[model samples]
Target chain A: MHVLRPLYVVLALAVIMLIARSFWVPNDFGTHEQGYTYGWYRQSNVEEWKNFTVKYRGKEFCGTCHAGQAQKLASAHHKDIECENCHGPALFHPADPLKLVLDRSRELCLRCHTSLFYPTSQRSQIKGINPDQHNLGLECTLCHKPHEASKPGRRNR
Target chain B: MNRRDFIKLAMKGTAVVVLAKGLDGIFRPSDVQALATPLRFVFLVDTYKCIGCGFCVKACKLENEIPFDADVSRTWVERYVVTSEGEVFADTPKEARNGFITGQIDLGRGKFKDIPREKIKKAFFVPKLCNQCEKPSCVQVCPVGATYQNADGVVLVDRKWCIGCGYCIMACPYGMRFFHPVHHVADKCNFCYHRINHGLRPACVQACPTGARQIGNIKDHGDPVENIIRTQQVAVHKPEYGTNPQVYYIGLGEEVR
Candidate 1:
């Protein structure tokens, strides 16, 4: 009976080790120690986001490379906005170039760009964005370039 | 006693008149929607700065991967030509054709550049996209709940849920919604929920070379887009339709006269 008791104790010890390992360390799927699949996903806040960080909408970077563009963009709605905000996860910027995920769509623009709409006003003559009539074979990039403002004339600057 | 009672009744009658007047304001339909929790974002289109360059059109095509040739375009920018005599006309492509003005490299320069100062009556280019109508007609007519107004007041379509029933296409007075050929479902501008919730601006706003497209949170007092609209006398395209569209254009000129 005493010998059998020792065997049961050893089995119990092994089981305890297994349970402890689950909490104390990470497995292939990830755990408290290993966190999420993506390292950035493990982060808890903007600061913890690791790869992506706000450099003040990168206005300062623009200031260093293109001074005039920084001046013009600084005063617009984009003044407080960060470059990574529109460009998406720019974790591998100049180093990898290709990793720059750009978010481009009219729907994204409508987020904050919707203020100009006032349908009930007495003086409001137009009805909506009227994608058909107003925008003449052109696009938003024709005039506005938030990141570099690299228009043909301003490209060198 | 009689004189005292008569004076009291007169005072009571006056109070009722004043109360009736105050109640009138409650019943008046003066944008009761504003009282409803203001939307997360407000969209603004600065008509004054838009030069009809078609950049928005090209960008939309590339970003959304819309077919190069489809009569129903998800997005396109056109030129609105208003003459001196007050006749307005928008020169939009009749079909979803591409490679327009490829050789035309005069990026809104020369010829009419002088008109901003003198003889030109009112010739301006306004880039247009989906208004994401607040009271979107698209939502009302969708046989399946494919199209709906999101909590933010932006109209969106669940492509997977859509049965390709073109009811929403006809319901929309603005004609912003369209059917996708490959997916065989309804599609339109979703305001890029992918980037927006992640704290990023839309592509058109970022790509705009002229600062024409401005986006902001309209409901918040702190948002700049709200101030831009408040200070400027912006107008919509078809107010008579009553879609309560969110896209606003400042300095709207003559239309299709």
Candidate 2:
């Protein structure tokens, strides 16, 4: 009976640890709105995560150099979007900026402009062309310039 | 009772009481899972509108700083083309890393050589991500309780405590969860929790040029999410699994997996 005293103390300590854990963990774990939570884990030190170097430097970065194209893109449908969204990331941008790959494929235009099986009401109100009927086997840039794709007077076809 | 017996019973009773009191707050039933507040974030994916441009994929990779790997990406676009003979071919090669345009491009491993349009009867793109279920299996299977459904109804992984057990990865019915290549912990889309908390759209939604993706508070009446759910016919990926996925799809073809 006397020897069992240590075992009982160990069991009690284990129970206490379990109870402490229940209190230590956040209440919102797996619960909605409190956000995700972890139990007894070290927090990710993300103090420096706020201002890390990024690949895509936004439209302003490109606009600084190619003021002519930037000015034209500003008046187009893609005004709100970034230049790097289509042109790829501008990591070595200002140093060797002219080497940017120019994508003038019709498939690129169809990516956003071609309407398919989506409910018409839910689709973007922008007019889409049926590939087979409109400008078949022709480059999209032949009719529409990349900078001013939807501008009224610039449309050829 | 003897003195010893009385002491043992008292200790057991105290332990039980303390445990019940302590766990009561954490282990409450999630019956109010459908939004205790007026804010219910809903993700709408229009399969008809998606053109497999892979812009959303690139945006998510950049926004989350996730290394772009086909197997470990937060989101991927699937291209489904049905033949006139009723044969369906679906593939997501490198999550369309270079954008699915005609020309010289290495479509590594998956051998996703584009089938000519003349042989295809119909084709469309379906973008996939974590469904963020109401009763998420990933959350249930997480041994360490690392994965949890947040208040915004988004399922997220607490990377800090995750043991990299990969249990949640297997448990997810939609096959959304994956082990982060660098972190070695389970990772998946949380509807971009870091951005959405700041009152901005998720990276995928913001990057979609065709307006194929939209996220709105379903609780708000007349909101686009609510209006679509009320007026349009939307379907979830797998309702039979009973995951109750939050991602509602419009024009989801029968061929989509």
Candidate 3:
């Protein structure tokens, strides 16, 4: 009889815990169907996305405000590059035009972009050039792709 | 075209003219022979006109469509401010839609010092970009043949070929290269070759409200653009590195010390 009573109490507690998890036992009830809950959901799923598809194709966000500057970047293949690639997440600004977030660094470009650090992509083996001894202290974008091809003859734009 | 004919032509040609041309060799070695100096392209950044705006920082973002936390900064501008007491301040670079808003400073307010007489009368904005070198260290240091120096003198990396090793990152004297999170490879500015090849200035130059950064070819003698560099006392970042950089800084301040 004693063992049966203990088992019954244990079963009752398990059911209560299950009920608390499913229903409103403070933690679950606090965020139930609220904005805070949805916000949390967004935070968890944000990193899974790979590509950012804009409603207007090729319309750079920075260009909208700085038209003259935008025209310069678009003069060549740079036009194909998406605006957010170097800037970071810009979702808040589109809805609120004045709310702008801007940050930049050469390290950002030198790090992940394989094309800026290596010599050739055709070869299987890829390695980083020690920036210290090779070209003095110059960055790749200075002479190569700064706006357009700026080459003496074969310029793209 | 034969040596005998050339000798005859030389006899007819003025000796003084040839020697004058020969003296040209002593003065301007690069112009002495055609194809003597390799045809290399380079960029020059004029530091004075920078309004301390970070438009280039933001444009790089949209053009590359990079993530917010992305470490790659294709182009950027930094503000150097100094007070009479030798206090220096620099603003964080940003590419906001409104322009560089990282850290705001006002000369009128004189936050650098209290007394107006004691306040710093000289505070200037200096912009920085990739100093495409005549001889790129990144190209030579690349072990896998991934980073290359182009005919125009600019060094570039192939994204498809690069491995995320980051030897270049450690080797860079200016600390330009970075390792991206998603792709996990080395990346940096290509000087917007996509646009420069198209015959346009970079986004930063275009967006600059004060023409602080000027882009031009160093070899085009006929163009008036060459004067800006020739007449100015120019400086490059980390000249001790012996990179022979293309980007030049005019009127460098002692605060650089």
Interface DockQ per candidate: 0.02, 0.18, 0.01
Question: A28-65, model 1: which lDDT tens digit per residue?
Answer: 22211111111111112212221223222233544565
User: Compared to the true structure, candidate 3 yields what TM-score?
Assistant: 0.50
Candidate 3 on B1-257: residue-level lDDT in tens?
Answer: 99999998888687878888887665443333334333445555655545444555655555455555554566655445555677775544332333332223433334532223235446555555667776566655766545555445455555555687888778777766767666767766666555555554555555443455667777776544467677767777787888887877775666553
> Which candidate comes out best when scored by TM-score?
2
Against the native chain B, each candidate's TM-score is 0.73, 0.84, 0.73
TM for every model, in the order presented, reads: 0.52, 0.70, 0.50
Candidate 1 lDDT over residue span B92-209, tens digit each: 5522122122211222324222122133345445566788776677777766555555446555565545689899888878777888877788888655544455666555565454
lDDT for B239 in candidate 3 is 77
Chain A TM-score, cand. 2? 0.60
Looking at model 3, residue B105 earns an lDDT score of 46
- Looking at model 2 chain B, which ten-residue stretch has the lowest summed lDDT? B98-107
TM-score of chain B of 3: 0.73
- Candidate rank order under TM-score: 2, 1, 3
- lDDT of predicted model 1: 0.54
Off by over 4 Å in 3: A1-157, B1-39, B68-71, B93-118
